[model samples]
Target: MSKVPANEDFYKVHLLNEWSWKLTTPLDAQPHTIDGNHIFEVIFEGNNTDTVCANDGHVELKFAISAMEQRNPRMPRLKFVRGLSTQFEFAMASLHTNFIRGRFGLQLLFVSNESVIPGEDFRLESLFSINDEVTPGIFEMVNIKLGERDNSTTSTLKSHSNTPQSSWPTGFIQARPVCYTSERYREVKASRDAKLSKQRTVLNTSDQELLLPRTLPYLFYAQRIKPTDDPHEVVGMRLQNISFGTPGDGYYAHSSFIVWTISFGFGEPPIDTLSPLLIGLITLSAVVVLGSLLFGTMLILIFQRRYRFGEFQRLTETDTTSAVST
Candidate 1:
């Protein structure tokens, strides 16, 4: 019989497997523009080996931007979306300029896909931190804490006793944004309720509202920086935060993520004296050319009429002279 591996060896193997799931972004050490409509792309690749394909799990990615400190207790939480493939891309147009200028936190949560059993309770807690100063376009993900739990594990096993079974982990698979202001909170809640109503036809509506926690207990903080001298210049961003579950559970965690600031300058060019002056010159040149052509045409017509009149006068004078000579 084969002997079981020791704890150290087991953890090492697990790490190796986990490392196989690679996260990649297109920045390549370049700063991201803070311009409102930047496109961010992230790719997740996994080996199709048995260990990685234990249950054909998929990945979900989420992110949020918040100030380094919350002056308002009612800040919105992160936004999340499930990835259908290895590559995930989204536009950052929704990011508010005021919220992005300072030291803000950018939280990314990754989750594996799992079946949701009815009547089961699940929970998740995640935290990450940066080990060093993150410069514009330069940062790394370190100290990642990703965990989940499900209460219906034993019952689900019993129900599938006679069939082939594989253990699957289940828990919260998405992030919910927390809005600080009452008006914003109401707006978000109404949007969510509307979405839930539409999804009720296809999914269990009872649990849809419970998928995300209603409270904003965790505070995400970052160090704020001054705006750059140039509006179009890119800047560096450093983010830090602590996230945990209910107190006394000792599940607290901290993590850091970096964002490169970029600016695409989406609006029209700045209005300047030179622009107006050039436009005026061009308009004046066009008018002058048109006026010259009109005057030249009129002169030609006048010259032709005068020349015909002179020819008629000479013919009449010549006829009068011949008659007088006869």
Candidate 2:
């Protein structure tokens, strides 16, 4: 296992063998934008090593695997894809976007040439804080939450028993949501009262019908509010309330709108969908370039052979003319 980086900014995260994703929107006509160009770098050290890494350049991996897991979950086994250190980058893009409905969902696709290990799915809850400030809900924002397992022991075992050996840990982690409303703006603010404090309405009314992720059980969101005279005006007075976390089989799996995406990959050739789509696009582009080179080489060879034959005929004709003159 690699030592945890000393810098506080380098947070530890857990990646499961499975992949999951989600996207949410505002309740009304709130402004919103989503860019899924995030990257996940997985470094593997093990007995069978065949990985790719670099001191400065981007490390290219043949196949990568990742999944949503609670706290820093344990990965007891890892395979090296190349002789060098293995690193990877995953990209994000979507088929479409919706403003009126205030809802968006992420699609999951994985590709890998390596075998995968079993693991748990969880949210990275440890990063959420109560002291973070607030921002007015005028538009929407989207961010990624990297998860780390709370304990290494809380993972799947390689036993013959069909039943689970132990229960999963307590919490899940989540990234902050984009809140747009009538009032102020504060970044990275956490609130204890996610629902009652200053909850932002989901932009899409239709999305109010969907369910949350099955792995996340709790629901926590923040809001910015201005006190008013009427007690019942809590919904109107608050500037923003952004939803964050939910427990497994809880309100999240039952929520109408949720915004998040998961990227993962597996081990082996003919990479599985488990490989991220962003990566797939890159591999496809490479194949096209190689094909073009092969075709161009064949055309050049044919033209060269024809020119040589024509030159040989001209030489023969000149030789015959000289012989006739003599």
Candidate 3:
């Protein structure tokens, strides 16, 4: 069938095959761009040309299956999507703004041609990170605490997830993101702006919240932090272990979404919340100091009372002697 939405460019889908894409639009270099592409070129479809633009160049995907099964027992899977469906949609508004939240936003949607099984979800491990490099002071991974909010309370993922994060805080301190220039990729660097310190990034309360990806309630957004340390780990988040769909569950049985908005090049990534261990230590110290003060106050009162009592007795004896002499 012909592609829908007449004004949009056609995107081809693939199944059981390795595919690539290149955007028809040429990369333009000027203000924020060094070449035709934005300095931090967000790429898709394993295609050098499919760079995401400020335009709502949303790509849509669907899956179709044949009755006749094709066997490839000898071939090992090199990528997750190779064995899944072929079509995909990278949806986002092409809004370009100076603010980090406004500048970059993207989402990937995947639907099933057939019902899926438990533990049979498409996933991409280590989506993006520079950890493969031998360079020093470099690693990758946005250290999301084990119990961070992986999904909304009403989200299917949250209900189905074995790990409950109802009590966990949705905060992350560090992530290593690399930007793609027209030429190549490079590691992100941290800034030593006066407002930042190792303990925290933003000095001002308003700016502190600015570090959060306030734009959307993304599934995972450790992609950009204002920058805790210069090195983003060898970690890029791609689709990972989405087991929401099942063959007989009905409406949502065959589809799952790998949705996230990029919070790159912002003022600072969200800073770390105080750990329980630190909070406990502070509380213990306060208790100790207060106990010492209370003990010292008691000793001072006792000494003062004793001194007054002894002086009063001496005065009484002197007055008695003077009366007898008179």
* CA RMSD, predictions in order: 24.5, 24.5, 21.7
- Whole-model lDDT for model 1 versus the true structure? 0.27
Q: What range of 10 consecutive residues in model 2 has the weakest lDDT sum? A: 107-116
Q: Against the unseen true structure, what C-alpha lDDT does each candidate score? A: 0.27, 0.26, 0.28
TM-score per prediction, in order, is: 0.19, 0.21, 0.24
lDDT by residue (1-326, candidate 3, tens digit) is 11125564332222111234444333562134222211222344331223342233333222211122221111110011112211122222232233322222221222211111222322211223333322123333233221222222221222223656343223222222221111111222211001111111112223324423443322144333222332222112222111211223221111112212121111223322344766788789999999999999999999999998887534576666765433
> Candidate 1, which ten residues in sequence have the lowest lDDT sum?
192-201
Evaluation by TM-score, superior candidate among 1 and 3 = 3
lDDT of 1 by residue, 221-241 (tens): 111112333311211111122
Output the lDDT of residue 318, model 1: 64
Best by TM-score: 3
Error of 3 at 270 (Å): 20
- In angstroms, the error of model 1 at 187 is 29
> Which stretches in model 1 have alpha-carbon errors above 4 Å?
1-87, 94-114, 128-148, 153-163, 167-326
Clashes of each: 20, 78, 22
